[model samples]
Target chain A: MIEEKDRTLKEKSLEKAPTGINGLDDITYGGLPKGRTTLVYGSAGSGKTLMAMEFLVKGAQKYGEPGVFMAFEETAEDLAENFASLGFDLDGMESRDRLLVDHVHIDKSEIEETGEYDLEGLFIRLGLAIDSIGAKRVALDTLEVLFSGFQNEAILRSELRRLFRWLKDRGVTAIVTGERGEASLTRYGLEEYVADCVILLDNRMEEQISTRRLRIIKYRGSKHGTNEYPFLIEEDGISVLPITSLSLEHEVSTERISTGISRLDTMLGGQGYYRGTTVLVSGTAGTGKTSFAAQFCKAACERGERCLYFAFEESPDQITRNMKSIGIKLQPYLDSGLMQIHASRPMAYGLEMHLMGMRKILDTFNPDVIVIDPITNLISAGTEIDVKLMLTRLIDYLKLKNITAICTSLVQRESTEGINAQEISSLMDTWINLRFFESNNERNRGISVVKARGMAHSNQIREYMLTNHGIEIRDVYLGPSGGLLMGSSRDIQEAKETAEIAAQSKNAARRKRELESKLKSLDAQITALNSEFEVQKEELDKLSSEEALRSNALAKDRSEMARIRRADLH
Target chain B: MEDAAQNNNGPELVESDTTPDPEFYILRLYVAGQTKKSLTAFANLKEICEEHLGGRYRIEVVDLLENPQLARGDQILAVPTLVRRLPPPIKKIIGDLSNTERVLVGLDLLPVGEANVQK
Candidate 1:
């Protein structure tokens, strides 16, 4: 055998548990440490059991590391069958001796603990299971079931201590699932004290909206994610969230993607927006914010850059169908995995949870464009300060990652009434406003560029109509009346009622004009007076010389008269 | 869009109804022996569970001494420590099926439910 320094580079590698879940390894800062027990605690129906099992199945299938499942709740058959829904081939894995499901039967009635009984039986069973398949990972579906089965708390606690130490001693990465109990995490709560890492899972329902939350409570001896992240367990399996913690370092590509509408591209100041600029499209309800954002995402995907559309207010299927009618199809892109649509309600989660969910999806797909249609819905879950801070962090994260993040916010009015818009405007590198107006008897939509930094953009409001083809920009509707038509006729009447908005703007303009005219006249008179003063000074200088000569002659005549009188007298 | 309006109305009322009162008593029962005392304790706990704790308590019976290896958990030096777990300031009471007054006080099952007590 070669000496340690003489060995090949592969020999120096650390033993790793490849989670088999995509993007998970990156968030974990590498897979979970080898030969350590990680306690997965969660309230009922929080997907702790499912997450642990998936970790095992993925380990067995993806990496050649066979796994042993020490299930305390379900039978081997029941546990194996559940994987069918997620398309995990347990039988195939078992036949190859790559996976083993050992159900450690713990019934509450089997209580004959006499003396000095440690959890040697459990270790022997786990050891046999691991050795039979040469398994590298182990999962205990629940240690709580065992605690509930045994009445002796003291022994149970000591056994748990042994189990974790035993797992570490054997050099196997293990997941211990437990049902959350009152006050403490697990029913007995000893597992958390002994485990190398602790992860808490929670399923919370707010205002009738249910959400699953995953949090890394503690991870010993290394840096780990500390925030509670929202994860989804659908037919495909579980996906843990995007990393929300800010790190200035992220990969950015020097590329550009077009905003489908050429007019919009022009408004963004040329061929297209920079690869990573976050574009905010804010408009009132019914101004078609969803359609506006969808068009851009559609364009980006068509151009071969992947796009992930997050619809907070609509379902993915519904958005797909809706966009299809507008001639922007998502089905083909989704089929190719070039475009992904994620939909849920904002009230379904807290703001940070929402941010985490967004982060997770972004990480998994690595999309070039992430469109959160109606970020206003997300704001409803947080206070104004919270919304601003979250958005600032989110925008900063997107720009740093160089993923062009497009967000839509619903304004109460076409004009954000100036106050509420100020809160979000500072964070935006570009802002587009969609307006609804009424001209003649027809309702119309107008798109205008509010702000685009570092580039001159179109200032004129362009009327845009969503036809069967796509979003079509009409000519600059510069007619006798400026504002285009929008909303129902009844709402127009309502707008007119609220329209008591100072017709006195004309009067004010007239007064301003009169004041300006008067100020100009006064300025001209002052200029004329300055020239007159200069001309009079020149005339005065000439007159002063002539007067001096006249005075000299008069004095000489007086002297002569005096001289003549003196001579005559002598 | 119209469906969203209808769905919003239903969730509004469900949220108003399911909010829990903050001051409810919670208890987790721990037991080991299956003797007369253990049986009597379980029975007494049931009567207490239905009467004072009703809809508010969560009882988790743990048999430790029988499974001597499991006894170290909850730091059990004795047979029964009824852990009054939540709305806590968690208090633990140890007994063998006899002390009703201490159990009631330990559970905070006093002050209001006394008038309806089947003493």
Candidate 2:
């Protein structure tokens, strides 16, 4: 039994204890060692209490590891009530006795720390608390509160050291949270040094934007994240994102999907483009830029794929109605939540706020395709530098997340105004130019795929038409008359007249050939009739002569030899 | 305990807000050599001081090449360490100050905080 006890103690000395918090372990590289205390220092409203509770809750709930929480700041009832609001069943865990929330009331008025008095009483209480539940994890929340009444730093520091060492000796992984000091990482600098690991949480407010930053100041035996990481505190709990730096090695699907309009997809390679690629359609006003964007979104929605359309120029309702005229029905998809149309003027908010709103919406919806119709409008509200920076961040974010982002830019033909032309072109994976070219005395909107990275696309400027039916691409309209070059009313009129004349000549030639064949057949029939007539006349003459001979014979026989004539007539 | 903390307060030196030390400066120039580059750097710095820091600044030029031992006193490693010791926090800029905008921004003369866009 003695040998077994020593073996167990040796095992306990080497085992590492996990902090059991969702993302905290990842940040700490692994976790704090078992039986070692970690100091969690942060200012008020910095999620100190939440982190402590999460550590304990994860231990008790997930690992089936019992825990002890001694709160010097809040009563057990108060802690339990706070947990109830967060939907954490603290009472249920307490009933199972796998968890214990102990309230240590250390009133400044009654406390006295003398030199001879060792922290044996406090140690005894902690031991009893851990022993009762066989707890492996312990939390002493806000140890700084004990120093509120004490003026001597040396005494407080020694007491903290004793507390941490006692907890370690008891073989329990302890978390001791404290308030941040003005200059030091923690209230009592000694606590940070004595603890096995130290984590600093900062709830900072800059430009009215509240952000929480977590940094691990020190970890004795383990490697940890030393940089400040941004974390989000929501109703559920804290979520830490390390700002995923994406690698270009992630696999992408090369299969093409139709863009609803067969002509549009045909212009973009045979079928369409690979998924998760940004497509930029830039043009001047009234070049069917929005129509082209709407076509892709409509196609995605039709395929039961989710699409998010951000219309900066038009409202969602107006876009829906306008699309209806072009036979692009989006209402059904909107009703099904598969299509989300978000519309707002560019001047409605700042550039960063707009980007943040887009980010929030993206996180919530996670659609397959995202469309930012006319990004120039959104960027025009900011300075060139701000626009470039925001676009860089947004594009980088999209590429990292592998989201297919399409942006339409309205390039004014009269004025060369855009959001940093260099960056706009550089950031886009593909750029499609839509221009109105004069053809046959009429203005024709020409759609051409200028560049598609890693894919082949038709380079010809196909004539595009937007009618009541939908968008259409006419055949490569090329002719020797150069009707496309000389686009005027007279040119169109001449072309139309020329087409009419050509059709008339084709029909006249067909009619003349038919008449010539019929006349030849009629002449052959007339010759055949003449030949038959000649033969019939000969036969008729033969028959008539015979009858004449018979009559003459009969007459001769009657006049001379009646008997011979009668025999000849017979 | 407060007395003990006081005992370990290192050196007891009362610094004034008005009087400037020989090494301290409202304006300062730090150089390492008399090379053409360093001479041009000193000339440019002197011109800036005469223009912007004429009345308010008392320029103190520290040549590290002449007194290398003084480098340790100011914890200097690079050639030029312009310490604004007259002002609190003693802002230091180590360069020839050829890029005016960078010097201004790095010296806190220009507002380049995260919340503020310099451009």
Candidate 3:
């Protein structure tokens, strides 16, 4: 029994009592300080009471430690009925001798005091309740009501101090809840000052959208996360997201996975993305970005791997119908439950809620692959910093879990392709940029690999077409002006080039029927123009290499990291 | 018993201490044990009833220490608490009952005036 209170992993001086709430234990390192009263304060509807109740209920059910819940404001029946929605069988737990709920209702109008008295009635009731269940944990929700219940503040304050002391002496891990005040943590500003550990929950509205956040104010002798983590109150109770979860701890995978499109796969290191790496595809609207995300999901399902697809702009039905037009039949995978498409609007939640919601889905689905179609719409949910912050931790988590992630981003145009992806591009292992190329008054779709971190990928722009079957990658060909030619302009360029090649090398073209060779030989006959083109290509390569350079301004940043991971093998 | 309570010689006396009282007081004194505070509260209440309500009041001492679960019935929290059971609207008074004026107001024996309304 004593060992239960000593579950601290780091030091023996400070013990912990694990509150069975999900994600809360992860942030508090283990749980609240054991055998000591921890104060949780929040405004009305901030979930302070629910958190405290869950703490006691979880202690009773999971840790085999019976608990006494002393609710100052609500009845035992009301508490039981309220928790039933969260799937906690409070009445059953009480019946099984694992829990005891004592409702202490104090209406100043219903009582008469004829003499000087201490809170001995409260003490006796709490003692009997605790002893009845042999409770190892206790929860006093909204204990600040003592200020309102009793008229004499002097004696009530003294008794409160004594009550906390008595609770500690009893050696039961306890949680005390307080109502949030304007200046102090509690309305009376006493519990926060007295408690060993203090946690603050805030549910505030920004732009008419509310988000619940929890923060640890102080943990007397222990280290805790200080960041304001967002939490959601769902059917399963409060789930706090410890966003400070990942920091360069992801293990790298060398195994390759296919990108679904054969030619597109070839463009990306002749295989596809790294097994557990984040792949980002940035393009303008109607540039086949969603199609790429869908293809990624289909490929995962084909390989008998579970995939989860998050569609932001389209509904699940809409996406299924849209993908059907491109000949990507997702209904079979949907029916087989191999591929799960979850669709929601960007305005539905704050950035943290969306991220936490995805984290929850990721845990339950445990998918091998995840696709977020057009993450650019997430900008509606938060600022650029928020989107970047969410993507950083999300990608790191996915990599740590060894799940392949394909995230699509929609930029404004071809000129702003990598620019829109600038905030997220650095985090991706592979960046696939699609373009809506317009030439000769018509637009065509083209794809290119901007960066593939650990693998060598083709830099050539490959024109692709949406056919009756799906996306078809066309032959790689540059126009006479050394630019990407799309639509009928590409066909016109190709036919004109073919005629020029036949006229220049009738015998040489016959000797080598391949197009690449014919073009190469034709360049041989072009005199000084070929020499000038060679010099230009050389300079372009240097400019491109500088961005990927340790030879440039980014080298100093690399040297610092290189110093950290300097163990015999770089 | 003290000069502080004797100071509030208001209309409660004109109705009860001076005239033949008809309102019977059924008071329940909730105490945890025979502690000094509980005993002091009980003694003070007996003297207050003798002086104020005379033979019209009846005091019942319920020790919560002997029956701990009985504390929940009247939502008793403070030790040595007084419950006015016979009154149409029940009221509670907590503490050592040292402040007799406040106890009178709490038990509806004295006019609480704006203080009761404000609370």
Candidate No. with top TM-score: 3
DockQ of the candidate models in sequence: 0.01, 0.01, 0.44
Q: Using DockQ as the measure, which candidate wins? A: 3
| lDDT (Cα) of model 2 | 0.69
Question: Which scores better on lDDT, 2 or 3?
Answer: 3
| Candidate ranking (DockQ, best to worst) | 3, 1, 2
Best by lDDT: 3
Model 1 scores a C-alpha lDDT of: 0.70
lDDT (Cα, 0-100) at A495 in candidate 1: 59
Task: List TM-score per model, in order.
Answer: 0.51, 0.53, 0.75
For model 2, residues A457-528, the per-residue Cα lDDT tens digits are: 887767777888778887654455654432344445568879999999999999999999999999999999
Task: Show model 2 residue runs off by greater than 4 Å.
Answer: A1-27, A60-64, A74-98, A103-125, A149-154, A190-192, A205-208, A234-236, A243-256, A273-294, A305-322, A325-327, A336-455, A458-570, B1-119
Q: List the residue pairs that clash in candidate 2.
A: A441-A487, A441-A488, A557-A562
lDDT of 3 by residue, A1-570 (tens): 556655654355577899988788888888988888888889998998899889988898789889999999999999999999778899999899898888989786666554466888889889988998899999998788878877777788888889899999998888888888877668888663465888999988766567678999988888888888877676568877665654686678888999988998898879988899888898888888888888888888999999999989999999889889999989999999998999988888777678778888998999999998877777667655545666776787798899999889888757544565887788888888888777677888888888889888998988998875777889867776788777787788789989998887987766677777878878777866788889999999988897777566576666666778773544
lDDT of 2 by residue, B1-119 (tens): 23432432222224233344433336455556665545665666676666655455566676655544344334343344455555555665544566555555544556646315645
For all predictions, the C-alpha RMSD in Å is 23.6, 22.1, 25.2
